[model samples]
Target: MPPTKLAFFRYLLIDEMLRSRSRPFPTKEEILEACNEKFGVNSISTIEKDMAAMRLDFDAPIYYDKRQKGYAYQDPEYKFLSVNLSEDEMLALSFVETLLGEFRNMPIFSLFSVAVDKVLDGLELTKKLHTEKRHLQQAIQIEQAPYLKGSDKLGDLLRYIAEQKVIEVSYQKYGSESTKDYLVHPYLLKEFRNMWYLIGYHEASGEVRTFGIDRITQVLPQEKDFLPQEKVNFDAESFYFYCIGVTALSEKPAEIRLRFEPFLANYVKAQPLHHTQEIIEDDEQKGCLLRLRLIINHELKMLILGYGAGVCVEAPASLAAEIRREFEKGVAQYATKN
Candidate 1:
């Protein structure tokens, strides 16, 4: 007879107990207690019936040991479920594994790698395509940072965030000589462009601030608990909604219009600079006029400067003036040097 949904869960629980290192070879009484706790009051007879169904239906190698006085698996490595993937599914899995390579040295990466390996083993794909997996790694290339400083603090920061514990971080900003300490109520950790940043409510500043993890000198946990008001209730999407990159210069998003050359416009259309980007006008022979609603910040300026001569700012006179002055400065420097 096929197992019912509840019976299937009972089988899984029994299997876990049998294979568990710490609590292996669970007795009938122990199995009853565990099942009752989760599924609410199952009898010893029910467990026996479930085990019998498992052995008959799935060919489970479960047997009672007279000496051990409990049930155990004859084949220790046996699993109840067998996962089979389609050709397209395997290709997708391979691509995801390659993408995870970007986060290689980080603490989270190790955790993810172990989970992925377990999944591959469970699906029985590891043994079949071990050689192909290696080739895929070589064929698919991803940009990775040489070294990420302060990655060691990720574990501790994650713990503190979960525990709601206040922490004192010794941070040194770029171009600053001295290191300063701040009492921060860490809310979220964000990764952008291979760099990690901590978004937290600053006790002294009375506002939420972003700190570069790479610049953090030291992290010390504080005994004081995170106050209720100190919790800004941060939402990553909402916080960065109208912003570009890490910085938010203003609360409101400004209307930004730019005309891009034919070639660069195609690239911009494919890979937009911001989510708010819209194609205002598209001309095959002329160019493309794109509009974005984003806060004008340092990163935005740098991006605009990077596309020099290929892009022309149409709206926001202040932004246009700023970009023009930047180009003027660049020209003046080159002209003087020449």
Candidate 2:
């Protein structure tokens, strides 16, 4: 069958079951299998999405009948709305669902994918949206996407934050490999480069600190009272706003200059390393000069070094000199090895 005809046929599966002529109220799995057998839309998850869209967008009166052990219309008289779309609209909808699926992989926005599925289902478009999206995903490439770890701790931590409770956590810092316990006044959760981090006030340290969720081994909610005012106040809008990765820089942002080789200049312009980046000068012969207002931190140094010889720190002679010294030490080790 052609795309439009295939879409209409899928609608018949759910609509036929909803009408009083109902032989048996079809379970989601039944509808899902029927569509899958006829059309190639697999996955029970997709069926839930379709139902969500059906209710939210088209006001399709669908409800589950416990006695029948399957779905039924709350109002038996209701009919599925006819939604027609041009080819462009179909592709756009598919792209949106694909993008949402990407965001949903992140611990923070994980539920967003379901919302996208509902949007597609409500439009009454069938598997064609996913068919287009799948093709697009295969053709495109996403480079060096950071992998997230420590999803196990996310659920417990979220509950602790919502309950306004202090928790005793056993955390193992990166590279330490040994877990240490601390009384934490949990404030917020942050995602940096796809990794999850917990921001809280360490009761023993009397200072705010961030902990990687992956590093946490245990979190036990404590009845020990805590006040909201006591929560870590970094004063910045976002915990990681000033710094890259999960760490925050306490020092004020500075005016720093950098010069990138001509070959890398255009790429840097298109994908800025930081939000404060500004073009100080760009000339074919002179190379690309850029300025940024940011704190100088360990992470900042690492980011600069990532470009290797393609980039150089220009101003704040101190920072430039530090880079030189590190390179000299690194070179000595390699030279000795040779």
Q: Report the number of the highest-TM-score candidate.
A: 1
Tens-digit lDDT track of model 1 for 12-99: 8988899899988889999999999998746888988889999999888999999999999998868777565788888888877777
For residue 325, model 1's alpha carbon misses the true position, in angstroms, by: 0.4
lDDT of 2 by residue, 47-121 (tens): 777777678867888888899898878875466864679998888777776666655555645666766677667
Candidate 1's error at 236, in angstroms?
2.8
TM-score per prediction, in order, is 0.84, 0.69
* Candidate-wise lDDT, in order: 0.86, 0.78
Q: Model 2: runs farther than 4 Å from truth?
A: 1-92, 99-111, 144-147, 175-177, 224-226, 229-232, 235-238
